[model samples]
Target chain A: MKTVIINYGAGNIKSIQFAFKRLGVDAQLSKDPEAIEAADKVIFPGVGEASSAMHMLKQSGLDRLIPKLTQPVLGICLGMQLMCNHSDEGQTNGLGIFDVEVKRFSKAVKVPQMGWNTIHNLKSNLFHNINDAEFMYLVHSYYAEICQETIATSHYESEYSTALKSDNFYGVQFHPEKSSLAGERLLKNFLNL
Target chain B: MLTKRIIPCLDIKNGRTVKGVNFVNLRDAGDPVELAKQYARLGADELVFLDISATLEGRKTMHDMVLKVAEQVNIPFTVGGGISSIKDVDDLLHCGADKVSINSSAIKRPELINELADKFGSQCVVVAIDAKQIDNEWMVHLAGGTIPTKHYLFDWAKEVESRGAGEILFTSMNNDGTKSGFANEALAKLAETVNIPIIASGGAGTIQHFIDTFKIGKADAALAASVFHFGEIDIIDLKKELKKQHIEIRL
Candidate 1:
């Protein structure tokens, strides 16, 4: 399988690569458009500020190329926020893969909703072998508001979309790479799909 | 709501896990990678690997060990001990560590914390404080809890958060390895003082100790080594007990 992890220099891509390697799949980390385009699957992962990540993506022209990716593409954490129409973080606009806007959690609650939380109301094949009430690791301050494209929802002071799927583009707000067995199953489901 | 976290700390020296792990189902007893995978299977919220190796060659060995563990484990793992600069953090993160914990170096030059937070986001930075209670005041210790500093524990914790630290791992040297319990009073004080989450480390002996750390200490997480390393405490059973006690744990 030719899987390419879009590296725009925003967050740690090495862990994601290692996760794939353990699955008996050798995934490639590439910024070259040709490698990304020719891949059977593309994983868009990020872990930094939305505005800066967007700037880096634009600089590398991945911002323009990402939304055009026809293969199955999965965005994680900041990658998920960037797949939205816009984000409250630095007031940045993102790829319109999902028609949703990212908003910061209320100051009334903890800003960075760290630790494990369960995802339910599953609506995608990405959760094939995963059961409901399974916990996943999450660390983010901003979250995408619930939308029609939402495939899974979680709660942290309020209901929000934890996973979203719009056509070939899929995004998960939590770090499946850091989430244990169920997370591995979810990634395998994505790959199989 | 986000649940309380349970983290098993492993001491790695010269590329191998020290103090032979005695978990019930551990495949390879002294292998960090095998232990990591077993911990993830047992539903440990996270893992912290403390590199006790001091020499340059040992550091290289530690890096190779981290790469091996990362290749096998799929959960968040943190690397700490002897991390001195941006390059060290860069190398570890590049080797697939999810986060890097800064200790003595962060105290020697406080600006190192800011530099790391700037280079990698604060979420990737964890500031570990080793403190020894002195004269009714918890004084911060440097150089692996040997040299004492003038900074107070609560005050430095607040400063670490303000300076862009993602979280604080507070280890009470007096309470560490005692196996009686965690210093809940000091942990509560630090938790109240900092807006960021506080990970309470040291002196965890029983499952009830973990309970007290979360409820009384108000710690976001609890870290222990010996009890977990020696098979005295089972993480899954501990989580089940925490859940029964309404401590809000991931089961």
Candidate 2:
């Protein structure tokens, strides 16, 4: 499969590419719309401030092209948060791929819920062989509230969408690339799908 | 639920692991990448590579080591030591390092924290503070706790957080090699003082120490070197104990 990880000068895309390489797939990093459109699987990744990342997306015009793609797209971390309707981080609007709004965790808990967390309530084939309450590494300050598009839930202060699915589009707040064996399995499932 | 993290820190010099790591069935124990892979397989939540290389050439080799580790290992790892500028962090991240921990450099110029946080986002920026208690005051130290600085531990932590640091890796010099236990009193104070995650480093000799750090210190993560390197504690066994204690570990 021709896998292309959209690189728009956001956060670290090399780790994602390396994860695919470890899985025996040489995923290409491309900002070229044509190369991305031609790929069988497209991986959308982002790390950093929402408004700036969105601004970079607009600069490269991937912002307009990503939501319209038909192939199975996986958005990770801030990439997943940017797929929603809007984010409270920097007061930026998302691509509206997932019907949810992103909000920051309250002071009752840590602002950025870092380290490993369990994802349960699996509802999509993206999870496939993954068991419920499996550990996945997550590092984020903002999160999307549980909604219809939420395929998996994790509790920090309360339940929030850890993974979301809208038809062919899949978004996970956890870094499957950095999530060890189970994360690798999820990526393999995505490739199979 | 977000489980506590167990990190195994590897001290690197010229891209080679400095301390002797006794991992059975490993061909080369000095190779950081090999050791990192072993740690990931052994269920270490995260890995920290503290590059202690002094020469420019040694620093250059760290990049290659990072690339190799990122290529072979799937778990998240952070590269630290001698990282002073945005270019240094950029090169490491491009080499596939999940995060870059800044120590003396961030202390030297506090603006470096804000600059990094603004450029790379706070998630990728980790500020490592090495401090020791002096006359009932936790004073931040430099050069691996040799040179004392005027900044207090809690004040420095709060400063870094206000400057947009994502996490703080606090190592108590007094408790580091002693391995009696983590400085839970200071750690708990730091956790309450900052809104971001706190990584308690040093003084981890047993499984119970890990438990105390998490429960008493209220640390989001605990980091150790000798205990893990010398085979004094097995990560799986320790995590199992933590799980049994209802501490929310990823066993």
lDDT of each: 0.88, 0.92
TM-score of each: 0.95, 0.97
Best by TM-score: 2
Best by lDDT: 2
User: iRMSD (Å) of candidate 1?
Assistant: 1.3
Model 2 per-residue lDDT at B211 = 93
Residue-by-residue lDDT tens digits, candidate 2, B1-251:
89899999998888788742221122223679888999999999999999877899999999999999999999999999999999999999999999999999998899999999999999989999999999999999988788999999999999999999999999998888777999999999998999999999978888999999999999999999888887899999999999998998888
What is the model-wide C-alpha lDDT for candidate 1?
A: 0.88
Minimum summed lDDT over a 10-residue window in model 2 chain B is located at B20-29
Cα deviation of A101 in candidate 2 (Å)? 0.6
Off by over 4 Å in 1: B19-29
Runs in model 2 deviating more than 4 A are B20-29
lDDT of 1 by residue, A74-135 (tens): 99999999999999988999998999999988867655677899999999999997888889
Candidate 2 accuracy as lDDT: 0.92
